[model samples]
Target: MRVLGIDPGLTRCGVGVVEGVPGRPGRMIGYYVVRSEPGEDIALRLLNLDRSLAELIAEHKPDAVAVERVFAQHNVRTVMGTAQASGVAVLAGARAGLPVETYTPSEVKAAVTGSGTADKAQVTSMVTRLLQLDAPPKPADAADALALAICHIWRGGTRAKIQAAALAAARRSPR
Candidate 1:
């Protein structure tokens, strides 16, 4: 399955595409960071982010989108911006008719590094190794985005299979 992972931020939103099945290493299709000027108006920034995400969805044609769920932070301003960007990402996936899932930072870390409290360096190292990349993806955001994709492939894929099986079984049963 092809999955798009988004690490949403006001200034630099990381985007990554990975393709693979459960229990297998994911191959990186592409990775990019969508940048919006901090000085720009909030509405404009969000619009640009939305447009960029839309373009990526069109280009990659992912089966599903995995986004970093917004968590509370001390800085309300920072959290607010992240939340808005995250909303844009979700909307882009929904607009493209793809299943969108959000994973917390801890969930992504645990999926990739087997530790919910893994640091950025550890996550990057694990992601690089898992994807068999020559080097770690630049900027922590980029690695985080790829990690999110890998997490979805590992976790979400299994969930999807189980759900599909249940649905098929239900259809086979009497009403």
Candidate 2:
């Protein structure tokens, strides 16, 4: 399966794509960033984000879209903008006929680093090591995107296997 992971931010959204065998861990395909002017109108920012995400979806054609859940207790404006960007990303995936999935930061961190309380540096280091990249993903946003992809790979595969097993057992039972 191929998955695209998104880390949403108004000014600098990050995206990463990974592909793997149906039951195998995700392997990196690409990672990058999308940026918009910091002070652009919220509507315009959303529009741009939507467009960029659509382009990425078209280019990658991932089977699923995985995004990080929002976590904020301060900077309501920033949080709202991030949510808006995330919505646009989900819409893009839906438009491409891809299923959308979401994971929390702690979930992603734990998946990648085996620690729910991992900081950005820890996640980045692990992502780099896992992907065997010469250097860690830069600009925080990109690293975050890669981590989301990894998290989904771990969670999504487990979920899919459980679903398949349940279906198989159900079929085996007398109806």
Candidate 3:
């Protein structure tokens, strides 16, 4: 399965792609950060995000897209901006006919670091190690995006195995 993970922000949205079979660790396909200025008109910024996201999806042809769910509390405006960015990502994936799934920040951190409250540095460090990369993904946002993809692979594989086992058992059962 090929998966893309996204970390969305108005100023900088991150994208990463990983591909592998179920029950196997995925290799990174492509990862990068999309940058836009906060001062730029929101409409224009969103357009750039949308276009870049589409290009990535078309280029990678990911089977699924994973993204971080918003959980902002103190900054309503920030949350809204991030949410909009998330929507743009979903739209891009949908446009390419790929399924889109979201994992909460805590879920991603816990999967990647064994702790929901792990800090950015910790998450990034572990992501680097998990992928066997020599360095952390660029611009922090890229690392965050890759973390979401890793979390989905970890969780999705569990579900996929259960379904596969069920199918195998049914096949073996008497007609």
Candidate 4:
């Protein structure tokens, strides 16, 4: 399955596309960072983010979209911006008719690094090792986006199978 992972932020939104199945190594298809100036109006910033995400979605044609869920932050402005960026990502996925799932930061870290409390450096190290890249992806946002994709492929694929099997069993069982 191909998945587009989004790490949303008003200034630097990270995007990564990954292809793989459950219990197998995954490869990165593409990675990009969408930038918008804070000096710009919110509307324009959102538009820029939307347009960039739309293009990425069209280019990648992912089966699913995994977005980093916005969590509460000490700075209200920061939280608001992140939430707005995240909304744009979900909208893009819906427009493309793809399943969209949101994973919290801790969840993503745990899936990629085997610990929810893992630091960014730890997560980056694991992502570099897992993708077998000579070096870690530049800019933490890109690495975070790739981590989101890897997490989804490893976790979502297994979840999907379990749901499908349950549905099949329910269909065959007597009510």
Best by lDDT: 1
C-alpha RMSD of each candidate structure in angstroms: 5.1, 6.1, 6.8, 5.6
Candidate 4 lDDT at 79 equals: 89
lDDT of 1 by residue, 1-175 (tens): 9999999998999998999988899899989999999899999999999999999999999988899999787368688899999999988887676777889999999999999999999999999999999989988898999999999999856564554456556657788
| lDDT (10s digit) by residue, model 3, range 101-166 | 778888989988999999999999988887888888888899999888888787775553454456
> Candidate 1, overall lDDT?
0.89
Angstrom error of the Cα, residue 165, model 2: value is 17
Question: Model 4 residue 128 lDDT?
Answer: 87
**Highest-scoring model, TM-score:** 1
TM-score of each: 0.89, 0.85, 0.85, 0.88
* Tens-place lDDT digits, model 4, residues 1-175: 9999999999999998889886677988978999999899999999999999999999889988889999776378698999999999988886666677789999999998899999999988998888888889868899999999999899855554454456556657787
**Candidate number that wins on TM-score, 1 or 4:** 1
Between candidates 1 and 2, the lDDT winner: 1
RMSD score of candidate 4 (Å): 5.6
Q: Rate the local accuracy (lDDT) of all candidates.
A: 0.89, 0.81, 0.82, 0.87
TM-score of 1: 0.89
How big is the positional error of residue 27 in model 4, measured in Å on the Cα after superposition?
0.6
Give the candidates in order of TM-score, highest first: 1, 4, 3, 2
